[model samples]
Target: EPEVTQTPSHQVTQMGQEVILRCVPISNHLYFYWYRQILGQKVEFLVSFYNNEISEKSEIFDDQFSVERPDGSNFTLKIRSTKLEDSAMYFCASSLTPGGEGEQYFGPGTRLTVT
Candidate 1:
C-alpha cells in the first residue's frame, strides 16, 4: 500500500520569512494538489499540478506561492513569504485519474505557525 508523505510535520516561522513544504506521493498517481485549512475555517484549494504544469489553481494561490516537481517522485510547495494570516494546516494530495473520477489520497499535513 502506498501513501503520500510530507516532511517537517510542524513548522514555526516569523512573518516575512519564506518556507518550503515538501511532499512525496504515490509514484503512479497523476494528479497532485495543495490545500490549506485555516484554524476554524474551511479547507481552501491552493493549486493543482499535472503533466508538469498547473492544471487548475484558485485565487488564493497568489504570486507568493509556487509548486514544482523537482524529480519523478518529489513534489514541493514554496511560499515565497510568510504572513501571519498564513498560519494553517497545509495538505498535499494525489490521485490516480483512472476515468476522471479520482479519489485523492492526502498526507498527514504540515502545520504552519506564523508569528
Candidate 2:
C-alpha cells in the first residue's frame, strides 16, 4: 500500500523561530490533516484541509499555525512562531474521505523540539 512520507523526521528550533514541516500524502487521498502529540499526551487535532481550503481546525490551531498545499503532491504545516510548548511529534494524515467516516493513514511523524 502507498504511505505518507515526511521530511526531516527530527527538528530542533529555538523559541520564536519559524518552522515548516513538509509531508507527501498518498497520491489518491483527498482529505489531509495535521496533528500533534505533546510528549506523552494524546494526539491532538490541529487542522484539516480539503479542496485548497481549511475544512476545520481545533483551538490549538491558532494564528501562528497554517497549512498549505503549494503543489498538487505536497502538503505542509507551518508554525510561524515556535514556543516551548509547541514541541511535539507532528503527524501528517490523509484519507479518501472526511476523517469522521474514513480511515486515515498517518506518516511516521516529524518530531519538533522547541527550546
Candidate 3:
C-alpha cells in the first residue's frame, strides 16, 4: 500500500536559518495538510491545500511559512526563518476531501529542533 513519507526525521537548525521539510503524500489523494505538535500538545492544523490554492489555514500559518507541490509527488513545507519556538514534530497529511469526517493519513513526522 502507498503511504506518506517524510525526510530527515530529525533536524537541528539555528534560530535564524531556513529549513525545508519534505513529504510525499499518498498517491491519488487530492487534499493535503500540514500539522504540528509541540512535545506534549495536541496536533494543531497549520494549512490545507487543494487545487493548487489554500483551502483553509489556521492562525499558526504565519508569513514565515510556505508550502509547495514542487512536482506531481512531492509536497514541501519551508520555514523562511526559524525560531526556537518552532521546535516541534511536523506532520504531513492527505485526504480525499475536506469534510466533517474525512480521514487523513499522516506521515511519520519530521522533528525540528531550533536552538
For lDDT, the strongest prediction is 2
The residue-by-residue lDDT of candidate 3 on 1-115, one tens digit each, is 8899999899999999999999999999999999999999999999998988888889999999999998999999999999999999999999887744689999999999999
- Model 1 has an lDDT value of 0.93
TM-score of 3: 0.97
Poorest stretch of ten by lDDT in candidate 2 = 95-104
**Model 2 over residues 1-115: C-alpha lDDT tens digits?**
7999998799999999999999999999999999999998999999999999999999999999999999999999999999999999999999999978989999999999999
Error of 3 at 113 (Å): 0.2
True lDDT of residue 96, candidate 2: 98
Candidate 3: Cα lDDT at 3? 92
Candidate 1 Cα deviation (angstroms), residue 7: 0.8
Q: Residue 56: error of model 2 in Å?
A: 0.2
Model number with the top TM-score: 2
Better of 1 and 3 by TM-score: 3
Q: How many clashing residue pairs, candidate 1?
A: 0
lDDT per model vs. reference:
0.93, 0.97, 0.94
- Counting clashing residue pairs in each candidate, in order, gives 0, 0, 0
| TM-score for candidate 2 | 0.98
Off by over 4 Å in 3: none
Model 3, residue 40: C-alpha shift (Å): 0.5
Instruction: List RMSD in Å for every model shown.
Output: 1.5, 0.5, 0.8
